[model samples]
Target: MELIRYAFVGVLNTGLGYAVIFLCMGVLDWSPVASNIAGYAVGFVVSFTLNRSFTFRSKGPARRELRRFLLIFALAYLANLAVLVLCVHAMGLDGGWAQVIAGFGYFGLSFALSKYYVFAEGAGHRDAGSTGHV
Candidate 1:
């Protein structure tokens, strides 16, 4: 159930991101790289809010959570950019199509990293399962 909600949020974010990229590059005649940067910036804010409040429901320190979130997203952004460059420039694909492919390509890895690293709690513990000791 939670995973479904998380996936829904991701889909929304992805749509928002792709729309911005497509509009900036397609309608406005911007470079793919420039449009991609703008699209990523906007999507980062949306992803942060949805993931923090809904997906992971993080209750950790705000500053730390934000920092970690940015860090993880930085990596994801790089991966996304690499995919875009390869698919668009190297393969001579359409910019919008390239971004579409990259978006799907990076989704799973981004989710896993953000779940386990960005919004995680309790000093890096992953043993979310309980021992029923109390």
Candidate 2:
């Protein structure tokens, strides 16, 4: 049940992110990289909120969760970048294709980190196997 909610929220986050990117690129004429960065920023907030309220049902302080979320996401971002660089340069993959592969890895890693670290069921914040807000 929790996993299902998480995936559902993830899909929503992806859609919202793409929408932001499209708007930025098409309407504002932003660069693809810039648009993507904007998209991910918005998506991060949405993901955190949905995952906390709907998926984990957490009951913790917003400040603590927010700080932990920032740390986890920062690491995730670096890891994704590393994967992308490795795939494109070392494996000779196309940049777009490399990003696709890296995105999958990021998704898995993000899920695990969200569950165990950012949204853990304890440590001064948690709710009976559940988690809370963005």
Query: Per-prediction RMSD in angstroms?
Result: 5.9, 4.3
| Model 1 bad stretches (over 4 Å) | 13-43, 122-134
Candidate 1, TM-score vs. the true structure? 0.61
Top-lDDT structure, candidate number: 2
Candidate lDDT (C-alpha), each: 0.79, 0.82
The lDDT, on a scale of 0 to 1, for candidate 1 is: 0.79
What global local distance difference test value does model 2 have?
A: 0.82
Q: Please provide, for model 2 over 1-134, each residue's C-alpha lDDT reduced to its tens digit, 9 standing for 90 to 100.
A: 66677789989999999999999999999999999999999998998888777776666776788788888888887889999999999999999999999988887787788788877853323444435432
TM-score on alpha carbons, each prediction: 0.61, 0.75
Tell how far residue 63 is off in model 1, in angstroms: 1.4
Q: List the residue pairs that clash in candidate 2.
A: 56-131, 57-131, 58-131, 58-132
What clash pairs does model 1 have?
none
Q: Over the stretch 41-129, how does candidate 1's per-residue lDDT look in tens digits?
A: 88888888888777777667878888888887778878988999999889999999999899876776678787778776722223357
Candidate 2 lands at a TM-score of: 0.75
| Model 1 Cα RMSD, 1 decimal | 5.9
